[model samples]
Target: MLRVCSVFLLAISPLLSLPTGMQNVEGEVSAPILNEDGSLLIKSGHKSSADWESFSIAPGEHVIFEQASVNSSFLNRVIGNEGSELLGRLSSNGSIFLINPNGILIGPSAEI
Candidate 1:
């Protein structure tokens, strides 16, 4: 009985260690750009330690990237996954910049 149980556990352990890919994807930061031919270019950045940064979103995807320091003032709200309109507010000490009219750059002492 013990040998049978050990064999079964060993057989299932490899499956338990399977890579689902989401874990690797989670830590990646992506920037999307438009090519002259109208194709999409996605550049991935590694997750940073400071957490106060922004990147261009992939075209046609409903998503938002936010930083904790400026969450309340800069990125006040994000549109839902359903594709609703978005509204944002910022503090006097901070600024927001729209990069290429697509990406939003938010910072404490930056400009839009």
Candidate 2:
């Protein structure tokens, strides 16, 4: 279960750059695809470029990325702007990486 705070603020960082092998896609990017066998995949345009797209989450919105099974050690990675408040419960055997140049707030209810 992923829950975002009602009054969350997304502060844009000018110095922050996209991760290697990832590119910024124009327009808004949607949530990742959740597989039936408990695996999640964030669609990319191509294997060489734009492997992971950037997206925004509105305030009070809940985004859930679920996987049917855990086959690998790395599951997901989330990159947000500074001063963003992320609140939710994450239960998965794989790993999750959150990257923010400025800072981020993880609520007490959040579970990895």
Candidate 3:
């Protein structure tokens, strides 16, 4: 199952939708861009974090992290009523902490 999912992601990683309702509630996070090409690119500075009303991604969509260094860490806290539906890619040089109290569905095509 895992192997199949991996193949699926590789086949479809360019189509997209991104996480919405994001706000920098605290820390040094900045300049999140959702490009027309369908990727969400976020630059994470040292000790940066953000909050989302909901956090999710669709197949082929990506949540990419750009940081000063690989040791940089960022937090994404979901405050919405619904659980996160992560069915896409989260490519990061650093660590990403996705916190959703409701629940998180990391789908078959997900690559984190």
Candidate 4:
């Protein structure tokens, strides 16, 4: 009887291990060097050059949005400016805002 019960339980074990139709998302990128104050050290590109860094993202099964282009207009404003860095955050409405340390908008502005 024990042998028969063991066989019955084994037959149902596969059902318990089935996936629930959930999938995972994962990707990787090169980590950047952060300053002592936790700011990223960005390397700007020259004219007619492409600039990029490898990035990793994990959005689980949900869709993840990638930025096609960083707002160079904002970065350009800081070309000769010192001690400026770009900071980004997601808004409650799902919009991305890049800000400077002083809480000023840092994207597409003539001044950084």
Candidate 2 residue spans exceeding 4 A from truth: 1-71, 75-80
Candidate 3, pairs of clashing residues: none
Give the whole-model CA lDDT for all candidates, comma-separated: 0.29, 0.36, 0.82, 0.26
TM-score of 4: 0.19
Model 2: residue 35 alpha-carbon error in angstroms? 11
Better of 1 and 3 by TM-score: 3
Clash-forming residue pairs, model 1: 97-112
The Cα RMSD in angstroms, rounded to one decimal, for candidate 1 relative to the true structure is 17.8
Candidate 1, residues 32-86, lDDT tens digits: the string is 3444654333323233121212222222222233323342222222221222112
Model 1 lDDT, residue 13, Cα? 48
lDDT (tens digit, per residue) of candidate 4 on 1-96: 999999997885433221122211122212333446433333322221212221111111111122223432211111122222222321111223
lDDT of 2: 0.36
TM-scores of all predicted structures? 0.22, 0.36, 0.80, 0.19
Model 4 scores worst on lDDT over the 10 consecutive residues at: 54-63
lDDT of 2 by residue, 56-108 (tens): 23233333433333432222233443343454334433333445454556666
Clash count for each candidate, listed in order shown: 1, 7, 0, 2
User: What TM-score would you give candidate 1 relative to the actual structure?
Assistant: 0.22
Q: Which wins on lDDT, candidate 3 or candidate 4?
A: 3
For candidate 1, give the lDDT. 0.29
* TM-score of predicted structure 3: 0.80
